[model samples]
Target: MTGSLRGILCVLLSAASPAALRRAFMRRQDEQRKGGPTMWRLRTLASMILLGILGILLATVLIGGILDVRLSRATLDHQYEERARIAASTVADIPEIRTAVLDGDRNRIIQPLAQRLIAGTGASYIVVTDRDGLRFSHPNPQQIGRRLEEPVSVLDGRSHVGIDHGSLGQSANGKAPIVDGRGRVVGQVSVGILENQVAHQLDEEIEAIALYSAIALAAGAAVAMLLTRAVKRVTFGLELREIASLLQEREAMLHGIREGVIGMDAKGRVNLVNDEARRLLGITANAIGQQLDELVPAGRLRRVLAGRDAGADLSVLTDDALLVANHRPVVVGGRPIGSIVTLRDRTELEALIRRMHAVTGLSNALRAQEHEFTNRLHVLVGLLDLGETDEARQYLADLASDQLISAEDLRSRIGPPVVAALVLAKLAVAAESDVDLSVTADSHLDAPAADAQTLMTIIGNLIDNALDAVSAQSGPRRVTLQLRDDDHHVRMVVSDNGPGISAEAVEEIFTDGYSTKSPRGEMRRGMGLALVRRLVYRRNGTIDVSPGPGARFEIRLPLSSLDPVASARTEVSEESR
Candidate 1:
C-alpha cells in the first residue's frame, strides 16, 4: 500500500512540480517588478492536464475492476448451483437407481449408474447413499461403502440444495432421496460442483472486463488531452486568473477615460458604448444591440459609425458641440470583425487654428508690402540720380498720400483693428492673385476681441474661396466683401464675379468631398464649405448662397449681449484712437 501511494504521489507531483518551481523562481525576482512573469508555459500546462487525465483514468479502472470481480463471482455461483440441482434430481428419478436402493445392491445397479451420469455431465461428485447417509456409490472406488459423516438434507427424506464442504471439497451441492417401489424414501443421491472450477470461470470474465475498461479509459484520457490543447490555443496559453484580471482592467480603463468611445460588432450593431459616447450621441444604455444607423442619425457621424471605410480624423458637429472623431475597423486574422470610434471636443483647437491662419495671412501681406516699398525706393533713387529732385519728392509724397487715404478709409468703415487688418491682408492676397478686391463703404462692426477667431474663420474661408474663384477669370475678376453689425446680429457677405456655380452643385456644395475643380495634386479640396456649415450650425447662425452670374454667400450670427467691462473696453479703445 505504501509503495502504491508513493507512486501516485510521484505522478501528481510530476504534473504540478514544474509550475511550483517556476513560481518560486519568479518570486526571487519580485523586487524588480510587482510580480514575476507567468508560470503558465506550454509544457507546464500540458503536464498539469496530463496529470488530471491520469487521475480520471486510474479511478475508472479501479472502480470497474472491483465491480467486475463481484459480478463475475455472483454469476459463477448461481450457474453452478443450478447445474448441481438439476443433476441430483435426474439421478433420484432413475429407475435403475430406485431398484438398486430397494435391493440394497450397488455393484449390479447404483455404481454403474453413478459412474455413467458423472461421465456425461462432468460433475465433480455423484454419490448414492442409504437412509443412514452411507455412501453406496462414489466416483473414487476406494470410497465405496463408506459412511458419510457430514449432515445430509436428503437423510430427512426431502430434497435439498446449497453450498456445502464435503469429502469432495467446498462445492455447490444438491441432494435428493431415492424412492422404493411403495414410493417411500429408500436412499439418497448427491451431486456437487467444485468451487475451484467456478473460480477459474470467473477469472476469464474479469480478464475480459479489464480489457474493455482499459480501452475506454484510454479513449477518455485522449479526449481530455485534446480538449486541453484547444483551451490553451483559445486563451493564448494564459492562466484563468490572468485572463480574468485583464478583463476587469480593460473594462475600467475603457470607461474611465473622458473621450467618447464606441465599439461595434461585425454586423454594425453597437456592442459597447461608454458613458461619454452615450452623452455625445444623446443615446441611453439601451443603445447597445441597436444598429449604427439608429445610434448615429446625422449624415457625417452615421457614415463613420457604419464603418463604410477606414475613417481617419473626421469632424462631427452635434447640436451644440464640435468634435474631432476617428473611426477604424477592428480586424482579427485578416478579417474585419468590429469597429472602434474615438471622439474629442475640437472647439478650442479650431479656435487656435483660426488665430494661426489669421496671423499667417497678415505676415504674407507685410512681405508683399515690403517688396513693393523696396521697388518704389529703387525707382525714387534712380529719379534723384538723374538730377530730377522735384520728381522724386513728388513721387514720395504721392506714395504717402495713398497710404493715408487707404488706412483712413479702413479705420472709418471697420471699427475693430483686427477686422481691418484681416481686410487689408486679404486685399494684398487679391493683388498677388491679380484680382480686384473691394470692401463696400457700408461695412462696420464693434464685436468683442474674443470673437475675432469666430469672425475670422467665417470670413477668411469665404474671402480665400472668393479670391480663388475669380483669380483665373478672363474679364473683370472682381470680389466684394461686406460686414455689418447691429445690437442684435452681425452679418457678412462675399460676392465674386467669376464663372458661376452650376445649379446641379447647389444641393451638394456644402457636403464633404464635393469639389468643382479637379484635384490634380492637391492634398485637400472641398472641405472649406463643410467646415463653414459646421461652424455656422454650432453657433446657431444662418448662411445662405444666392445664385447669380457668380457665387454670393451671406452669413448672420447672433450678437452676444455685451458685458459692462467689455463694452467699456471697446469704447475706451475707440476713444483712445
Candidate 2:
C-alpha cells in the first residue's frame, strides 16, 4: 500500500506541467487572500512559481528514494529478528536439545529437530552444537559427532548473525543463540538463511525507486526545454534587432575612419576594405575574398602577406608612379594571420621636396659668391697699398667700362625693367670687384611665367656666384652670361674664369645648407645655393653646375610654360631700363 502511494506521488509530480503547477499554487494563494490576478503579474509570477515547484519536486524525489531504501532495510532486519526469536523459543523447548547438546551426545532425535528447524524456517542450513565444541547435528554430516571450528560466542548464550562456511564448506549465515532448559547457557542452535533472500528484497525496492526517479527526471527535463523555448520565442526579435543595430554601427565606424583600412582573413584573402582603402588603391571592384596582389599588383602587398614588417612610408613605384605605403601585420592569437596595407600618393610630395632642395642649393651658391667677393675687395685694397695705384686704377676703369657696356647691352636686349635692372646691378658689383660679368642674350628678358620670386632667386644666385668665382682670380676675372630662346625652351648660361668647382662637389653643390666656402672667410653661412636650387625647381627649370676651366652653371626652362603676360612685360621693361 505504501508502494502504491509512493508511485502515485511520483506520477503526480512528474506529470505536473510548469504552468499548471504554477497556476495551482497561485490559485491557492489567491483564494487565501481573496484576490484576482493581473495580466502582467501573472506572466512574471508564473515562471517563478513553476521554478519553485520544480525545485521542491526534485528534492522530494531524491529524499524519498533514500528513505525508501532505509525503511526496506529496517523491515528486513525486523523480520529477521522475529524469526530468530521464534527459532530460539522452539529450540529452547526441545527436551533432549539441551541435554544432548551439553552432554556432547549426537542422537537421531536432535538430527531430526535440526532438520525440521531448517525446513520449517526456510533457512539455508541448520546446526546444533554442544559447549564441548562438538557438532551433534548438522544439515550435512559425514559423522554424527564432529567438532565445530566456530568460536564459542554462539554457544555462550548470545545470538549473532554473520556469514560463515558451514560444516559442509559452503557459504551460509551462522545466526543463532544457545540456551539451556532453564534459559541458562548451553549448546547452540544455528539457522543459516541464504544471502540472496535479503539481496532480492532490497533489489526490488531499489528498482521501484529508480523507476520513479527516472519518470520524474524525464518530466522535469521536458518542462525545462519547453520553458527555454518559450522564453527564446518571446525575446528572439529584440535580440536580433539589437544585433542588427550593433552591426550597422560597426560598419558606420569603419566607413567613417580616415585611414585606409583593409581587413584580411586567415587565408590572406581580403575580407573587407573600407571606402578610403578603395580610393587609395584606385580600384573600384570589391576586394573581398580576393588576394591582395590581384587588386594591386605591387609587390609590397605580397611582402606584407609574408609576415614582413614593412615600415611606415615605404616607397614603391607602381606603373612608374611612386606611392608611399605602410604595411602592418594583423595579429590574432599571437600569430600573424594577415596584413593591412595603406598607401598615399607621393608624387606631389616628391616634387615639393625636389623644389626645396633646389632652393637650398641656390642659396649655398650665392653664399659662396658673396664670400669670394669679399676676398676680392681685400685683394684690391692690398693692390692699392702695394704702390700699384696706376695698375689698380686702370684695372678699375677697365672693369667700370666693361660693366657699363654689358649693362647697356643687356638692358637693350632683355625688355623687363626689373630683370634688366637686377642684371645691371649685378654687373656693376662684378666690375667693382674686377670680375668680368657680361650678359649675351639673343632674346629679350622675359617675365617669369611661374613664381616671379623663384625666377629672381634663380637668376640672382647664378650671376652672383659667377661674379664671386671670377673675383678670386689673379688674372683678368672673366664671367659670361648667355640667355637665348630656343624653339621650345629658354636657356641661360653663367661661366667664370676662377678656379673651377671639383667634379665631386658639383653634384652636391645644390644641396641645402652645403657650402664649399670656409667659415673663416668673409662669406655668410650656407643659404644662397640652397635658395637658388629651390627657386629653379619651383619655376619648373633645371639647373646644372659643372666644372670646366672655371665654374659654369647652365639653366634650361620651357618658354611656353612661362606665363605669357609676365614674359611679355618683362621684355618690355628690360628694353625700357
| Runs of candidate 1 exceeding 4 Å displacement | 1-43, 80-108, 127-167, 170-191, 239-252, 260-308, 311-577
Distance from true location, Cα of 154 in model 2, Å = 83
Please give the range of 10 consecutive residues that has the lowest summed lDDT in model 1: 8-17
Q: Report, for all candidates in order, the number of backbone clashes.
A: 0, 38
Residue 213 accuracy (lDDT) in model 2? 89
Judged by whole-model lDDT over C-alpha atoms, candidate 1 comes out at 0.71
Local distance difference test scores for all models: 0.71, 0.60
Worst 10 residues of 2 by lDDT: 6-15
Candidate 2's TM-score reads 0.31
TM-score of each: 0.53, 0.31
Candidate 2 local lDDT, 1-577, one digit each (tens): 3233222222222222334334544654565465456543434433554566577768888898889889987677566545655565567557777776666663457888778777787766667776655676776677557776656566556576545555444333444556765777777666655546767877987998889887987788677657644543332212333334434554665666765666654456676677866776676887766776788764444464334534555544333233556666544224444555565655455545545644554555566667866886777798899989888788778767865886677777765666776676675566556676766645455544433443455677777667666666687888887766556676778788878889888866664335666542222323456555544564478888878678888888776556645555333222111
Q: Which candidate is the best by TM-score?
A: 1
lDDT of candidate 2?
0.60
TM-score, candidate 1, is 0.53
